[model samples]
Target chain A: MSAVEHAVVDQLGTAEARALLMTAEFGRLAFIDGHGPTVEPFAFALEDTAEDTAIVIAVGTGSGARAAVGQTVAFEVDEIDPVRRTGWSVVAVGTLHGAPATVTARPEPWPDPDGELVLLRLPAERLTGRRLRRETRRAGRR
Target chain B: MSAVEHAVVDQLGTAEARALLMTAEFGRLAFIDGHGPTVEPFAFALEDTAEDTAIVIAVGTGSGARAAVGQTVAFEVDEIDPVRRTGWSVVAVGTLHGAPATVTARPEPWPDPDGELVLLRLPAERLTGRRLRRETRRAGRR
Candidate 1:
């Protein structure tokens, strides 16, 4: 769609990208339903050794992430500054599967689960990223 | 991780969230890495029909989106006011798969090759979202 290009520029290479994934802790997950597509933001944990993999934070008896039990999935992680209008974004896609309920509930799902909890198996299929750079739109009819 | 907590609140029960997947338009994909997190805006085509429960937006080959072959990814869709710190975000998680090299060879990736392009996928897990009602520290501290 025309909108994507207008929003970003100068994408990064694979290595630069994986580095970003390793340190980040939260992002968004999207799903499609009968009405349309739904996108939601959530927290995730990545394997300490792997740079581009993630584990969704569990939220209650696997009931939270059960929605993506057998569906393809995608996520977006980025940092933005509302004041300057500058930031970068990375996109991820993969299949999401629940981690199967833990035999006995651990009362708390997250290390700090005031209440929210969720878990997911994110396997990346493709990885793409871009950097933020200012460029004037080409001369054209507005 | 704290930043993501707010994101989870907005999408918890919002089935009416926006991001016209079937409109054949583009949106933003946000991700995290060493640079914290980033956002890239791009365009895409809704590859399937409205009936397809799993919203699949095909990213043609050779485009930056193709880089998403096997990496953790997220997509960010928001409305821009350019003056206020008020905007919402929706993210999806998944990996990009091979749809045939021909698909990647499309003339343009996002409406334009030189423009930024972000990709997204629907998550299989239950959707949980948080909204930033006010700029305040997360309750009870994580």
Candidate 2:
């Protein structure tokens, strides 16, 4: 009998999703640029407060991420093992905004001696995640 | 007395960007779902022809990728070293469509015994990439 591999996907709750997000240092930010929809990687930090959790990123003055402010965007983080074909992904959707003075923790700006930088924050308004698992089964098995 | 690290970002040509893309096994797909803009990772294979190059991904029936058909999307692949804080990222923007019969090579779908799978293709219409390097300088040194 031949064996076939199957994938099982499970949905994680908000707490689990946020927990997973903390394990990753960087994530892809999806938003609409002048050309169209685009995704870029950004190093981010999580800002937790009694009110809400926010994704914070620091971008240089000329960075496109500056335009993303005031727009709804999705920040996604994941850890996957391509060899094992197993991993988990978490997506946080919310409106991007200028970081307020009260936000103490901010993502470190990349070394940019001449370029000014700004902080953008995205509160985790809607969080969702999925875990992928693989199992091998004999094709003839019931 | 102290040193500062700065990031230098370089833009890569189309040919070089495509070369870097070939080194990665998977990428993140950014598209707009009913909820809003979102991104998810997928295993992808590059379909190179005399005419053009396409990114092929196989998804199950329940995959949100199904709704991405006919929409403009961005596929990003990157290799980053968090510890060193340096890496390269490539973004391929294109329109998504159902894979054609003429297409021979396709991405492998995750094992899903109970779900039917379909193939989707995104031709690399506009490709852009950036390489980030770090340089450390003594304080107040040019």
lDDT of each: 0.46, 0.86
lDDT of 2 by residue, A25-88 (tens): 8888898889888877888899999989999988886568889889999999988888998999
Error of 2 at B85 (Å): 1.2
- In model 1, the Cα lDDT at residue A76 comes to 67
> lDDT score, residue B73, model 2?
95
In model 1, the runs with Cα more than 4 Å from the true position are: A1-8, A48-52, A60-65, A82-85, A100-118, A135-142, B1-142
Q: Mind giving the per-residue lDDT tens digits that candidate 1 earns over B10-56?
A: 33344534332333244554333343233445543433333232223
Which stretches in model 2 have alpha-carbon errors above 4 Å? A1-5, A111-114, A136-142, B1-4, B111-114, B138-142
Evaluated with TM-score, which candidate comes out highest? 2
iRMS, all models: 8.7, 2.6
What TM-score would each prediction reach against the true structure? 0.46, 0.92
DockQ of candidates 1 onward, in order? 0.10, 0.63
Candidate 1 global lDDT: 0.46
| Model 2: lDDT of residue A121 | 94
